[model samples]
Target: MTAPVSRRSGGRAARKAIREAPLTDDVRPIRPGMEGGRYKPLSQEQVEQIHEAALKALETIGLADAPDSGVAYLTGAGAAQGDDGRIRFPRSVVEDALAKACKKITLHGRDPKNDLELWGSRVHYGTAGAAVHMVDVNGREYRDSTVQDLHDAARICDQLDNIHFVQRPMVCRDIADNREMDLNTIYACCSGTTKHIGTSFTEPDYVPPALEMLHMIAGGEEAWRARPFVSNSNCFVVPPMKFATEACQVMENCIEGGMPVLLLSAGMAGATTPSTIAGAIVQATAECLAGLVYVNAVKPGHPAIFGTWPFGLDLRSGAMTGGSGEQALLSAGCAQMHKHYGLPGGAVGGITDAKLPDMQAGWEAMCSNVMAGLAGLNMVYESAGMHASLLGFCHESLILGDDLIGHAMRCVRGIEVNDVTLALDQIAEVCMGGPGHYLGTDQTLLRMQSDYVYPSLGNRMSPKEWSENDKPDLIENTIARKERILSERSAARFDPLLDAEIRRKFNIHLPA
Candidate 1:
């Protein structure tokens, strides 16, 4: 009896060691581009109704304020410009544009291993925002975000497995000139991470210089075009059926430069868009369809994401409520519309109205993130680190979000109900004249890493164990991890000579 007990205990110890070991990408329980169309906020009929409404909107109300070039592009592609200068798309023209659009796109990373295949219900989560302030969670204070903050965010993202891509999250307040800011944003992000990056240009004139920098980074113009790792997050349209003229010009420049475009239309509900949920979705869809038409008109089959980011609002105070349930529904519904068109799409999620990475922030971020993934959003942007309704970004929150998104992705992975998963053989073996429990079973040990996900910073110890181990605070642990990452030599940095040349050519604000 003593010998049997000792053998069982040793087996348990061996199993624990195996369970704690690091897992390879192939065997990891969750990964980028996991399939997640399991939840549908809009029914089939509702989706069709919304689509029809959007088409009607484009045909009648149309969009105003197209720039001279945009007017030419749209009119040249069968759109009618009335005396009011609004471009109206006929059903046939919109359909043609849809038919010509690229059905699938690959967002290449500088390292080929991080490439994201965007199509269908496959989901990938990443960061995106334009917050001007950074949240110092420890001090409970907010301050102007700098270029170094942006670079550090990217470096932290580089080490996180769950953050699939890094979009420019904050303004570089340290840089005074808009052109220099745009260039440095690109340089700071690219130099910190090999993942696919998304950024915006302040002016159409800024595009050429930015592309020149990208060419240098990619070795040449031809090489840059072949594997363009950067995408322009272009807010091509103003809300309520209108084109932002300069933004449109920026979109055209990015297209001419062979970069993928995220045709973002971010309309605040109860203000820019309609108060009702369905109404907001309809407006966002119409605007994005118009954008698709514009993209195809400029260059047929151009890669563009259907970005319908309709945010939520607090009707009582008329303030943005990015963490609300209505916001989740908006993102999920837009995702359904993207699926309806068979196009790669993106929407905002994991935003928090709370000022810090506190309890409110946790619930808010997790709620939308899970819903967004469940709805199968191809690119879930702003999926972490946003706070104070997009006014602030927190580095600790971004680090913690890696663990949060991992759990969300696991939920997105859902259940696998195969014969092996049924475990009838294992069950029978356990009950038939064997130990009362299956704690040290071969099946349990073998499936430990593949079938489960474990959080890195989230504590799961009991009170007794917690006290015995010296209780750890979540934020404290996160800060320690953040320090560890920044202290290490980053693998994501550019080659030394190449970095020196880039610094010489551009006024990069972040130190080498």
Candidate 2:
């Protein structure tokens, strides 16, 4: 369904409008367009082999801490579960589950009728599980993030149509007081917009609270699922390297609710995981597959998303190098690995480990994003401004990020052909025997807007025109653009009164 056109220029009366941008590059299908690069695309059969290898890792080595249902199924199906807490299954079991599984699913938004597109040809962008800082209206940082930071980020995200799903960013300030914190964030997303609301909960007791809050905001589980806020429910699957009791509960809730669950595992290469990128890829794959197989095992045919975010260690200080080349390779390889399983693949692009928004951040960020789109990842997260990755977030970075994603959309989309693009008849009609008369044709006028990319930053205006304009740098132009949008548009709200009621129940201070 066509979303409502909400792209008004922000508060700045004279600024140009920021249109609802396209997710994938509208350019593709052209033969040899941005294809056949140093990085090779995996063949369908090659992807299958990784799937088999992943299944073998599960069957032979077996992942530890599989749920009781998983253990029971593996044991019942001629598998072995040693007291060591690892359960090994034969390739047949995994193959059987995948065969019986319907990999295609649409996690419903508040309107079950409203579904996020998945498994399409191009990559769709999303955010990974967690991050700390957030950007405010004036491009300022709110560190250690609070409840207000969370809701506004969600609200800002809700307005940006290019973002496919809203992963629960660190909105709640206090992990210690999750009971009070969860309510504000969950209800804010439920009431603020119709985009998929990624649910947030941690630990055992937090599970009941999260569910209670979701029910409170959404009416109840049946209603919540019916007009489900979360379109695709992907979670952080604790690495074999670490444990969080709450992550497990989160997994359980995802399955029980039948939301699309992606088991996300991130471990550093050479540290928590083996030093090599290949080694980390396999280990991380094993980690997520181990959990996903549980999802399939518990409720046969349940929709599951496949994911991996394996970090690599910096040889220097033994730190988790988030935006390393190893990460890029791992994310691309992760997409291929998941493709092997015939499941939806999820990974990140547009990442930066830079401490600030600068050239290094933009360049490093563009590489991951472009590759992920070229590799055609199913769900690519961390699309916006993520500086130092999980360590920091910058405001201006988000403005720069959408353009990086724009380029990725460009790279993956390739090219499209039509009567206009071919220009065959037009060329013959306009310039058959004369000097180039094609420029004078109505055809050229009709096609200019279609072909040119009106970039947010890379404006190539004439020097005279540029001198005349009040806006100078790209940041000035972007700030003006944002003000125009927030001023002219407000997202679909639940109700001022119901919002007040939710705030009264949750004791949150919402935007007036």
Candidate 3:
């Protein structure tokens, strides 16, 4: 009996060792494109009501200030243009556009492995925004963001398992010209990560040059078209039923250039959009639906993301409250609208009104991120590292957000209930005096890796253990991890010759 017990203990130790070992991408407990939509903020009837309101808004209110090309595109697609120059979509026209719009899209990465399948409740989280400042948490100061900052952010994002894509998160304040800034933004983000990138063009002409750079990186126009790794985060609307004319033109160029477009409608609640949450959803939905019509009209079946990003406002101070519970509901509600239309969608989440990565930032970030994932947002943009109501980006917080998003994704993965997961046989064996506990059981050993996610920076030790270890500061530890990652050579950098060619072609501001 003693010999049997010793052998059993040895088996348990071996299993523990295996479980503690690093896992490959295939076996990691949480990954990109995990299914969500488990949390529905709106009922079926409510969803339909919002849809009807949006359609009604489009037909009645319509949108103003479309560029001439956009006007041609919409008018040609059965929409009517008013004397005031607003494009009004008849119900049938909007429905037709919806029917023709691509339901699923693959935002490819330079490396095929990072491609994101956007359909149904499949969720992917990543960085987004054009923050002007970089948060120096240790110094408690904010400074202008530079091209190097953008590149470093992408490099950090490439290593993080939970951040699924790299959207241009900060403006390159180092570059004065808008064209050069836009060009450098593309070059910096693409050079640091092979993950699907998202960027914006300052002008229609900028699109051609940016696409030329992308073509050079992709080896040719055909290759770039085959796997256009970057997407355009085009804010096509000026909110309250108006179009951003220049942005619309930029969107047209992007469509012609073979890039996916995120039709962003960012109306602030109580400001640009209606104050009521439901009303805000209606306005944003209406705007994005109009964008859908525009995209389909320009070229039927163009891949477009229904980006309905309505922000929350503090009625008292009249400031944007990105981390508020109202913001979470707004994002989740928009996600449900996306599902109702059966379209690929993106929404904002994990943004912190807090200025730093403190206790407030943690709760603020977690609340919306978990809710967004649970609500099945296809692309949860700004899901990490945003601060000061989206004015600042932080490297330390970005690293910490990787751990935060990992936990949120596990929640999104939810509980798996099957015969095997029920574990009736294992339970019976344990109850029948077979070790009296299941920790050392074969089922326990087999499921450990698949059933759990472990955080890299999060401390889970007991108080005594923590004290023994000198009570490691979370921020300090995160800084150390960030340093270590930056210290290593990035695998995502372009080849030497390719890098030289790109430098020769453009006034690349980033240091080699």
Per-residue lDDT of candidate 2, residues 346-372 (tens digit): 777666777766678877777777777
Please identify which of the two predictions, 1 or 3, would achieve the higher TM-score against the true structure: 1
How many residue pairs clash in each candidate at the backbone level? 0, 21, 0
List ranges where model 2 is wrong by over 4 Å: 1-49, 66-79, 111-114, 135-142, 174-176, 216-220, 231-236, 241-245, 417-420, 433-440, 483-490, 509-512
Q: Ten consecutive residues with minimal summed lDDT in candidate 1?
A: 1-10
Model 1, span 1-512: residue lDDT tens: 55456875587678667767878988999999999999998999999999999999999999999999999999999999998888999999999999999999999999999999999999999999999999998889999999999999999999999999999999999899999999999998998899999999999999999999999999999999999999999999989899999999999999999999999999999999999999999999999999999999999998999999999999999999999999999999999999999999999999999999999999999999999999999999999999999999999999999999999999999999999999998889989987867786788877888998888899987899799888988999999999999998667788899999998998888777
Q: Which residue pairs collide, candidate 1?
A: none
Per-model CA lDDT versus the true structure: 0.95, 0.61, 0.94
Best model per TM-score: 1
Provide the lDDT at 326 for model 3.
97
| Candidates by lDDT, descending order | 1, 3, 2
Off by over 4 Å in 3: 1-20
Displacement of the residue 482 alpha carbon in candidate 1, Å: 0.2
